[model samples]
Target: MDWITHEEDVWFEFRGNSPHQLVPGRFYRGTVDGYADFGVFVDLAPNVTGLLHRSELDKRLESLTWEPGDDVFVQVKNVRDNGNIDLGWSIRQGENEFRGARIHDPDGEADNQPVESDKSEQTATIKTKPVSGKRRHVGEKSEPKSAAAETQSVETEVVEAEPETEETTADDESRAPTASDVVGNLEEETEEAEAESEQETEEAEAESEQETEEAEAEEAELPERVSLGIIGDHVGDHVTVEGTISSVRQTGGPTVFELRDESGVVDCAAFVEAGVRAYPEVNVDDNVRIVGEVERRRGELQIETEDLTVLEGEESEAVEQRLADALSDEARPDAIAPLADHEPVAAVGASLLDAAEAIRRAVLESRPIVVRHTATADGYVAGAAIERAVLPLIREEHPRDDAEYHYFTRRPLDEAVYGMDAATNDVTRMLEDRDRHDEKLPLVLFLGAGSTTESLDGLGLLGVYGAERVVLDAAPADEEVAGETDVLVNPAREGADARDLSVGALAATLSVAVNADVRDDVSHLPAVTYWENCPQQYLDLAADHGFDADRVRELREAVALEAYYQSYQDKRELIADLLFDADEGLAGHVSEQFRIKVEDEVETAEANLEARDVHGVTAVVLDSDAFSHRFDFPPTALLVDELHRRNRDGDRFVTVAFGTDELYLRATGDLDFRTLVESAAAKAPAAGLGAAGIREGRIEFLTGAREEALDAVLAAVAEQF
Candidate 1:
């Protein structure tokens, strides 16, 4: 008889067997059907399949050379009620390797008797067997099969065996009783057996319940709650810990809860099932008690939770208070003695403390930080300073090697304002990361930018999604800018001269406040921002840190050149070498290129400068559109600064670079660009003389009102002088 295949009745018709008839812990012949990254699927019957999990393989999954439709052997580890089959690896790849035949009857008792395969009946033709009468199980050795069993298509073995003894024969005869004896004693035997079974079942259930109660009692008698700081000593021991949940992350196998107590933070892992959420009641910022055994994973200590319970009422309040108190004491600012007397510095220092605390909280919670800054030497220096301090802290907190990249990012913007373009880009990246990788939303830190009302639209977009923002700038920000951010650190907002401070100087101060150990490395950065007339206080600070003017200039120029090439990338390693390790010769080589590029641009701008007198003030104006390399290095800001330095002789002098739609301002006298632009716009409203770009010391005006705009701007400059 030949076998036939059918789609609707595939399993029963293909082999005269169904998957429901599969026996657990039994070996079966199969064919490789398909492969997956995790395991392989094997076809045992037409419609019955089983998975050979990667974990059960003696060798790597990739090492298996089997192809689809190839014959293979496997053991059925289990047959679940849902009809799922789990398979284990088999060392006996050939059918002859197995001993003991099973004579399976369709409707009768299946016995362990070697027999030949009846092709018409679809049964196994197992022939090998061991010498002993006892049946061999999986993983046991079997004796060699006789030549007849191997050669004959349908053959049976006639084995020489011992005959039954007199005692066995007599016992068998006594066990087989007559019909009269069976009917007479059947009721009594049935009653006794039923009573014994019930008694045994009752005893077993009572013992199980008692063991469960005792285990629960032991869990309830846990010792006093201990701090996570002392958890290292309690490894391999069961203990109880109470804390607030800082974060919760789900993985392929376990759910990790980041617990923060007064002492420190640790991760507790719980596994209910693969890809299933454990302790579904737990959430971030909730107070809970975790009872588990401490274990080490990937060289970091973690808790294997046996029981977890959320706290309420007084318990929750107590844990929250403890964490708050500990954070306050540990993260409070200790000293700003470096600039205490400077009221502007002191005011910004207070805000620095707040910003640092917020950043620390984000770190503790495993939230990412996105730093946005202007694409300038000042902005890059400031942004790099914070990056240096925060990276080391992130690495220390998160044990993974890629934590720095995952938790922190620094992006340089072409303009100072955080407009819709920049915000949209950031939001897209963050949302994608959250969806694809299960990452939490990030905190946006605006350094050296986003301090004007112009950025409110961009900030509002982020706020709509509950993302937080922090702004740290030296430019005087609009009053409304403070309301748009979580932490605003600007001296001008607190009544001080923003002109005297550089964003680099302010941000470096804040970076040290974030991590004090980097103070010596960042102290020199403030002095480097001043091209001339350095403040005595900042110069003294730099001198104390052993950074003279030449070394400061070298670092400043090196960073400027690098900022121009790949204006988008953070260039982390290159900038770190240039700023932190000045002796590496990288700064010298790059600074030389910076000098050559700036000198060429400056010489051209000076030659084409159109000088004029406006209301007794000497004004130097350059049509940068005609004379400058519009697409080259040393931007308009740097060009104007160098022009003012070389040409200005009197107190009332202003150097201006006119672009297509905007103007750059650099002056020798105490001229407030913010005040000048505001007053100018009021005088000539049609000229569009606005302070929109005041953060970068520039103003936008209507091209049609060129003469009126220049006159209004120069009048304000003259008045201030």
Candidate 2:
């Protein structure tokens, strides 16, 4: 055997093998070969030995005796060169104890001693030779065989001494030298020794045979293969194991159930009729076992049955009953009472309650509020009153001086009350009042003629205050007074009023806006309503302008279209003319570059066809004023160069549009052109031929009069071509 050593650790390898046969950090089962005061010697593996220190033995086990040939399981703690090895043997705390009998002695007792034979002495001497060098301590008990042998020798001496004593004492000296006396003494001693040896041999042989039988039995019991199964297989079919259920669901007629077990978990299902009846009691972690048929559902094995048994007993049953009662109560028509009456003052008071709640949520979530109000007496009074209620709530929620609130009122007090005149005492007084009152300064609500109009105005305030609107329906009252109130909160028929107010709906709306800001209960509100109610145009614009040039172009077109439509619908003519002029100019320039004459009468058709030739060039503009004309200017050339560079470097497709006096270009690539444009423009001037202007103009290049005049020359050549 070849051995390898790493410091105190050693491992042995067979000859011609690359890997060591025995390694450290592993436990092995072996037999005790010998023991000394220092430690017990163990045969760790075939041809390998290790030491189990006396100190390492469990204190309780140490008191019991041990001998050679005793089997033990030990961990290889360390190994050393020069054939030294260290081993440990002790059951770890919390581990299961051994099940076999606890034997304290290796040799049979005196009463059960076997008869001795002459050959046994030689064998005994051979086995004991290796252990003779180390002596047992004075207090230690003698070996079991030694004590038994001493008793037998003493008995033999007593029997032989009686015969010798019977002979004459005077002739004893003469008889000691005689052949008969010496031969007789030697023969008796030899017979006694042979008897003891024979007894020891028989006992050793019996022990060896028993060990061999045990080994054979253990080998027979070792399993050849192992398999795993769910606990339901062993337990009753309708059994339930309960814990928190994750990802619970139902499909079609069957309600699926997944129960987790110690090893893992199993999937089960119940029919619709079964599921509904079970639903009253079948909650997550109810500790119920349902008996069902084991079958496959959607390619996965699941248990299906109608029988249910609650394992948690009384507690789970009571919970199920209470849940059923609550649900039934909620389903009744008269579950909630109707409102009493509608009063303007009371409605305002109720609105203040809602406003207070909104403020509390906003403060907790660290979000701003966008309020819209009318400048009419009712608007002022309501707006002022809401501010009064909300500001104190916010201050109470957040006392930090660093806390911020922004106001985007319908119009500044100066603009609304004093107009352009700065000398008015009333305006000055109001300004002083607003400055002095922290609540008045942060009033973000706007005043308008109607609630719908007010909501619209409030939309603009959203961008300024980073807030969302929480609308409260106004109370139904006399038309004169009702029209002027902030919120129409009617107390007459509280049930219908609550339905109209929809606390859940409002919470959802505010949740969508402030979810990312709030940390607590407010964050738990569902976001479905926010997405559903978001303006389609803004959402569409955001989607199209997804931080890219294509998106930017789409956004620019949307913005320009909206502005043009809102400002002047008749500008369609201007748009068309601009597009046509830009197309003509671009055709001339490209024709001049390619040395091909573009046809005059057919220029529009030719430009469209040519644009289609370039990959990714989806839309082409013929109107110069269509926001694509600015690209033709020299200052905007850099943007075209950058775009052209990106197109060459990437697999993106490009689009060309011609504005009336300018050319517009856009490309789609992996890199974000919007961020690039923003970055480059940051170093340049705000406007007037800066990077941003160039970028905008490149996508909307403008053509000079000279270039427009050249269109005729190109047209003449295009006619010939």
What TM-score does each of the candidates earn? 0.67, 0.18
Per-residue CA lDDT of model 2 for 497-568, tens digit only, reads 431232222322222222222212221111111212323332343344232233223222322222222231
**TM-score top scorer:** 1
**Model 2 / residue 680 / CA error / Å:** 9.9
Compared with the true structure, all predictions reach lDDT values of 0.78, 0.36
Pairs that collide in candidate 1 are none
Q: Give me the displacement of residue 694 in model 1, in angstroms.
A: 0.7
Instruction: Please tell me which predicted candidate would have the highest lDDT against the true structure.
Output: 1
| Model 1 error, position 494 (Å) | 4.4
What local lDDT score does residue 365 receive in model 2, on the 0 to 100 scale? 32
- Give a tens-digit lDDT track for model 1, residues 259-357: 878877788988664446788877766899999888764358888888898999998899888887887776656755443245577776678888887
Instruction: Give the Cα-based TM-score of candidate 2 against the true structure.
Output: 0.18
RMSD, candidate 2, Å = 32.3
Error of 1 at 282 (Å): 4.1
